[model samples]
Target: MTLEGALIRSEGLSIRHGGREVLRDVSFAIEAGEIVTVVGPNGSGKSTLLKALIGALPPAAGRVTRRAGLRLGYVPQGLRLDPSMPMTVGRFLNLPKRVAEEGRTRALAEAGAQGLEDRPLTALSGGQFQRVLLARALLDRPELLILDEPTTGLDQPGQAAFYQRLEDVRNSLGCAVLMVSHELHVVMSASDRVLCVNGHICCEGRPEVVAQAEEYRALFGTGTGGALALYRHEHSHRHDETCELDHTHGEDT
Candidate 1:
């Protein structure tokens, strides 16, 4: 795919932690208004790649380029909030950066947490907390919204609902989304493109094509039969772009 005017581009990018290389010679580009999900087994450098793309980690080799003054909003894999410290959702959103009341309310509403403004952080359920995190990310009207496993603890129904909200957020904001997730079914169902990464790019393409690739099958098996069932149900309602799929069988990094 032509990645002209890419929001972020990496060429032959390599990353290292301590003495071991986490990712090597990886190249890809995230264009504006695209939803890209990175999937891999644990310790496959999925999180490392996200950090590199967002400039939280410097590349040990090659380069990562971002659009000038790119606005970024990141939702981490998990956030620990002290139960003893009293903090409300409203108070948390204003921390360090105070946005207008109208903007705050609109952001919360868009994230499907409209009435949660006054709720204490500790009072929210797992799914509600994730929505709050998303609300916080949307406050800045970011150009690139990066989420690392945003739906970790939710049950199947919750995961599906959250991903739907995520798709809604992307549509309403028109921001490119780069998220790391292990929920194959949800990722495949919602992504515009999926990248199967295990230390390096394994295979990347549309959800349907990637699901059938041998490389992807090798990493996550066909247990996704249920996921595929869900995909067929959802697929009938949407128009998917027709693009040639790209598959890579690189040696593990």
Candidate 2:
């Protein structure tokens, strides 16, 4: 991807944690008004990469650059709440800072939580809680939105609904979306691009292009379609084997 017009871009980025290198020589970019999904197996540094991009973890090498004065919104995997603490959804959004009623209303509405302002934080269902978290992220009307495994605990239908909400958020806010998700088949079917990372980027391209690759099709299925289809087959591949596909896109990428 071209870094010139990208909202955020990483150049030869490397990261380490607890004295072990987790990611190395990774580079990619997310442009405005686009949706990109990062996919990989467990312990592959997908979360670490997001943390590094958001400045939660410092890179061991290279750099992450953002456009001037860019406003970013981030939705984390989950939050630990004190069960004894009583707080309304609206009140929770104002924590560490406060926003006006108009902003809160708009954010909740955009997040598909229009009438949840008065609900207790602990009373929400899994899907409702996720929507609230999404609403919290949208409070800033960010130019870029980031989420880390946003649909982790949800079922198939819940996962599909959450992804649909993501599309709505991107359309309404006109912001670029960068997220880490285990729901690869669900998101890949709708994403503009996909990044397959295993500590480092093994390969990346438009979902259709990568899905159509004979190499991938032979192992993963014909394509990443129908949210539940990939569940029928096992998704296991040796990263070393597909690392060479990085150049497979070449001039087209």
Each prediction's TM-score against the native?
Answer: 0.80, 0.81
| Residue-by-residue lDDT tens digits, candidate 1, 1-253 | 6767899899999999998999988999989888888876667788999999878888999999988988888888888898889999999999778999998999899899999999999999999999999999999999999999988998756765777788778888999999898643337355687776767776566766455766556654654432321111122222222110111112222
Which residue segments of model 2 deviate by more than 4 Å?
209-253
How far is 59's C-alpha from truth in model 1 (Å)?
Answer: 1.2
Give one digit per residue, the lDDT tens place, for model 2 in 25-123. Answer: 998888888888887666778899999989999999999999999999998877757998998999988966899999999999888888999999899
Query: What total of clashing residue pairs does each candidate reach?
Result: 0, 0
Q: Against the unseen true structure, what C-alpha lDDT does each candidate score?
A: 0.77, 0.77
lDDT of 2: 0.77
Number of the top-ranking candidate, with TM-score as the measure: 2
